[model samples]
Target: MAMAFNSDSELFPMVNVNNAKLSIEEERRENVDEENRRKDLPINECMGEKDANLDAIIARYAETINKYNLRNLGYPTNQDFNYDKLAPLFHFHLNNAGDPFVGSSFSLNSSPFEVSVLDWFANLWNIDNSEYWGYVTTGGSEGNLHGILVGREQFPDGILYTSQESHYSIFKIARMYRMHCVKVGSLFSGEIDCVQLEASLLSHKDKPAIINLNIGTTMKGGIDDLDLVIQTLKKCGFTRDRFYIHCDGALFGIMLPFIKQALKVSFKKPIGSVTISGHKFLGCPSPCGVVITRLKYMSAISRDVGIIASRDATITGSRCGHAPIFLWYALKKRGLIGLENEVHECIMKAHYLLNLLRDAGIGAMLNEFSNIVVFERPLDDDFNRSWNLACSGNIAHVVVLQHVSVEMLDTFVHEFIEKRSIWSKDEQFKPLCIANDVGSKNCACLMHTTYHITFSFLSTFVTYPTTHSCSPPPAATSITVLRRLQPQILPPPPSSPSKDSDLTTVVLMPTLRSTTVVATVAVVAAILTLSLLGIYYLCLTLL
Candidate 1:
């Protein structure tokens, strides 16, 4: 005879307990042993002659890199590109020595290609071709260096101001130039705190302001409000001439133009310069970027170079001519429509990852119009290293670039969930509190969980039944339920909690009783029915 269940709870249980424990420490040890296998490989000692051994070493390195690329998820680098056709150009050393606009005596330069790439960006950024002057940089850091240099040249005594969340390169540049830098605070969403910025500006009213705005922050993918920032500057009594805003777009510089309703990084606004990384979103074979500033700004720093037969306006003397071609090819091949589709796809994948994490009861957050999904940092170092997860403080982020696919994300989430189970098996091992990092609403810490439940219960005023109570379970039980949800891993406890645990004791324990519980169930059922009817009627009226 088949088993028959009268209730849904009997048919489909909420938690299927798993008592087995996985040996993750052994697995971590195995990984360390494997990593040490190549420790005794060839060093920087010069080889006497070209031999088969050298070729073998190169081949082995390539194979290793190919394997590693599969798990390269931490950084915001797009690995989905094929530049095989451009490989033939590597035969000659190509260098753009000086200003691309001015004719260089060195006929080997790819200045035409570089100019075409700059013109495309200028148009995209709403700057007239004649009004803008820029060059292909080695990377985003070089771009920032050049953009900030332009601002510094304009205002020699100007104080540099950037949010604390801005790229580390910004502060480094300030140090290199020996400029006074004011690091403003950022909001919970990782965006620049305008209030703090306003205060900083007011305090430094004596000195002219040279602001470095992040189009997309490194860790959080937070877009500092350009309009609001500009408004703040004006409100602080800074005139257009008194301030110079340099936008370090980097990963999002090439992407933002393609996104509709996104704040435009344009010269039409009061921005002095804009820089974007070619390798980040475009997936160039090598690290490269573009920096565009007003043509008038060039006059302050540029000098005629007779050796190169061109003006010396750029940061570096010998620029990679091939970088421009790689950038140009990417832009032309994708066009606007292809790039736009890719941006949307990346954002969608980010949302997919966020939903998957939240559904698994992991604390996660995704900022609006961003492809970076922030979540609680994994406790296992081996797990973090295996997936190449970028972590800061209590939070970790996965930058969903064009190369990241849904299948890859699914695998990543699966592994993360599995590893998390192992990390939380001990009754004492509690999930880290990421409330300060991602805000309480998104955080799944015990303290925040209580707040969330209380808010929800208050919103619908219908009391929960003793049997079917809505209160959060005990720490051990909640961990068990989560493990049941992801049954593939029956793992062990983590090392230790990084911070203090806020594991609260549960109050409303479930009861298998009848008297008052039955009456409470009836009221709760009626309330849910009425709430559904109200939503149905609201939808009908809107239609």
Candidate 2:
């Protein structure tokens, strides 16, 4: 019988397979080494000729900024935007200070000035008491990761619980620590469901549990009820010590002090630890986050893990000195009253947009607690008719719908509507004739189109033009050609006029004028075309 062939048979029968594999791996290592050598080349040597190219990239960006109407936003285009004030506060030279890899070196130590500032931040969040303690991190994600790590350290076998709409980082942190995560459903009012949370806890009663409560969720800006969550935990016989509660207050922590006063609730509470991101509402350019835990729990994990002192409690080694400094500066600059005022303004702006949508008869959903508001465009009879027309002809009509919640929505909707209006008017002016004119036959087509376009434009105009000088000027009318055919029957208006008042009377004036102008323009165009054709024919004959 012929020798049996196997899929794993080596092509290099003369050489050792293991050695061959090792040789190839060595070659790959050499290639990587070569790449590293090339990368290590000095910037000036490697990119000498590309300096102009780099400058051109920035120039092109600037040109694009000019071409598009994006000049009003206070974003910096060059490097000269007040770097002196911000640069010294950064820990960019921390590694250069001393021998970074050494054990317990004084040069590698963190700034005591930074630690004092962090202490202030902890106090600001109501974590200064003997029962509470916390330290700064690079960002909310890192802070959350540290929080979960602490949770896993305390309750090694616990399942991490959070809302379905919680930040993705929560689940990621859980996975990083090899912990099981249980997501509970959210409420209709855009909050974590207390009942579902209770059920989740009961279902996972066999395992130690850690609840990751989000103060401000990414989507819908939903806030989980901490009071209810605490109550449910108590009902399940899970005390603060038995089950850790990590409050991910990244976006909302800075605002809590202000909001708490309005709600008449103390910020100091039952949660074991809370994480905060300074960049979201704190208006910081660099990343800065803090994790606040009870003093007992903090003390338990205070042992230094390498360069970071044991008591540091942060996830990373050699923490950035600037984070705590920035946090301290932000807290001091914007005191409790200032933060409350800013949050109040944001809420007011959000409510303004909600009111505008309501006044415009546009259906929308507004979150009562937080500043976020979400709403879809109303599919009214007029909108449906226009949409149907576009769909029937296979023309991709842009959906004039949006979803937003909070004060940010007000600004977004306003800008969106303004840009949409300009584009809509531009589209209307284009004389592209559709093959099927089903919905085009309606007498109210022009009016309805104009009305919708104007409505969208008005919405945008209100929001965007508030701080900017560049406002969309009035629309200019353009002449468009239409086929001459017998007038089609028009649909009756939804709300009929009074019996005494004639609907026909008011409609005839504009209808007649429009018809006359359209006819006159068409006749003129036809005459011009015929004249040109006659002249061309005569010239051909003469030749």
Candidate 3:
């Protein structure tokens, strides 16, 4: 009994498990109510309030954007171009034709819209072929894809030759078609190594190949010597049948035709096919690319891919109708003279920028044939010098703003020079040196220049701001230099009005005194006239 004295402990206390469970349930409900209260707080205050707040945010964003002078720095995805002005002429109707698509599958069998556009394009190229055929794609890349697909069909077992600097999409298309891509070396200037290309093609003489000639390379705005490439092809015994030449003139095709004519250079070599993007220099919205081919080659490619059908040559089905319409509208709006003027203006602006950079002692490069100008920092300069300076420690943190005014370019260069001076003394600082490095290191700046201009098509909508500011004040030496030199570079502000007592009295007091005197005289004359007239009326009534 003594040993079992554990009975002194009140045995087992009654456990209320249900109450604990009920308490947890109540806590959960309270938590849920708290959450609901938080959710309902904004809603209970107002119903349309969210939309109003969103609208306010959007308005502020738009205003801030307007504050920065972004004329042509950013590319635009869409544009109105006062389309509404010509809306009366535009017609929309249901298709009455039995087939969904009204246009012919083959571009040679032209529709009213296509025929007109093609004729205009052909005229720009100064080609005699009224029978030239081309179809509009999303952009140059898509155009290249279509061209490559056609090329593959035309030569089933042929290798494709393009510079190592050729656009990535070309390689992708070649791989997709299971074709061999022979990459030729690129020169420092960004042009393809014609000698190396010739050697590669000669080595592959036993196998059929297609040479992808780039009118303009993406990296340094380098243009291949078309004449040289054509000569090389001939020397290598490459013919139109055994090997085809596809020109990926995505960036320059639209402009080159006009440029050629202006320079009086002949583009008569009868290249097998050419691809161009309307969105690049021609300035359209979205992916509007044209694949131009001789009628015979077009016919051959059309028949080669019988299973896919020539109608389905494009990668996508149900192509956007707006592309053709917008392209046609743009071409019509920017006629031969207008296009020529734009090209001329762009070239002039580009040259101006190059000169500005050179004057500023910035090392920049320009192509003789095109408007693309790329510049980098000199190796000896202590400043941040290159495009990828931020990440690679090799170059300066410099950004190129495109479609810039002379004033804007001046300001950008000034600001960039000032920013670079801060890091000049720092042994660790290096500028991103190469164009590709700039692209990889600073996406924002890269976007402003290349991607926006070439691929994104946003360059039309935005412009570079007048003044670009940077954080962190420039180094003391640079600041001192800027302060000493700033007066010469920047325009002076307007002077304020003088507050001298004598001047105020002589100028403002006389004007006020004269105004008061004139008002008093006019009032007195009005009162006298009214009184005399009233008295005369009274006398007439008495008579």
Each prediction's Cα RMSD? 19.7, 17.4, 27.5
What would the per-residue lDDT of candidate 1 be over residues 1-543, giving only the tens digit for each residue? 999766755444444225533245545555565664643335233247554477667776778777668887889889999999899999989999999999699999899999999999999999999899999999999999999999999999999999999999998999999999999999878889999999999999999999999998999899999999999999999999999999999988888888788888889999999999999999998999999999999999999999988898988899898999999999999988999999999999999999999998889989888999999998888788877889999999999998888898999999988877876664323667899887898898655665576556543433333333567433222222123333333333344533443222122224333224434644775576566556645754654
Best of the two (1, 3) by TM-score: 1
Top candidate, metric TM-score:
1
lDDT of 2 by residue, 1-543 (tens): 799664432522343454564444455666676644533423234355744555655565556544322212111111111235657535454421211122244453445545565565566666555555556677889888977877877888989988887888998887788889888988644478889988989887878788898786654556788888889988987866778778887766656657654221123666667787865566555777777666666555656545432334556665665555555566677677776777776566556765765454333344544555444322233332322212222222211111112433454446545544664555432222222221222112223334444445433312222223375422222222222231342233338777764332222223555556546654665565566556645754654
Top candidate when judged by lDDT against the true structure:
1
* C-alpha TM-score for every candidate: 0.78, 0.56, 0.59
Q: Give the TM-score of candidate 2.
A: 0.56
Give one digit per residue, the lDDT tens place, for model 3 in 1-543.
355543422443333464653344455666676754633432223345644465555565566444343423223122224455545434542111111123534333224555566666656555555556666677888878877766777788888989886888988888788888899987755678899989998999987777787777765556677778777877898875677777888766766666754322223564666777776676564567776665555545443234323343345554555556667888888688877777677677777867776576454566665666565543443222222222123322222222346675676567667665655555432443354533332222222233323322221221122221244322221111121322343233325546532211112223444445435544665565556556645744654
lDDT accuracy of residue 534 in candidate 1: 69
Q: Best to worst by TM-score, what's the order?
A: 1, 3, 2
In order, candidate lDDTs are 0.83, 0.55, 0.56
Instruction: List clash counts for every candidate, in order.
Output: 0, 16, 29
Off by over 4 Å in 2: 1-84, 88-92, 95-110, 129-131, 260-268, 299-302, 305-312, 361-363, 377-415, 418-543
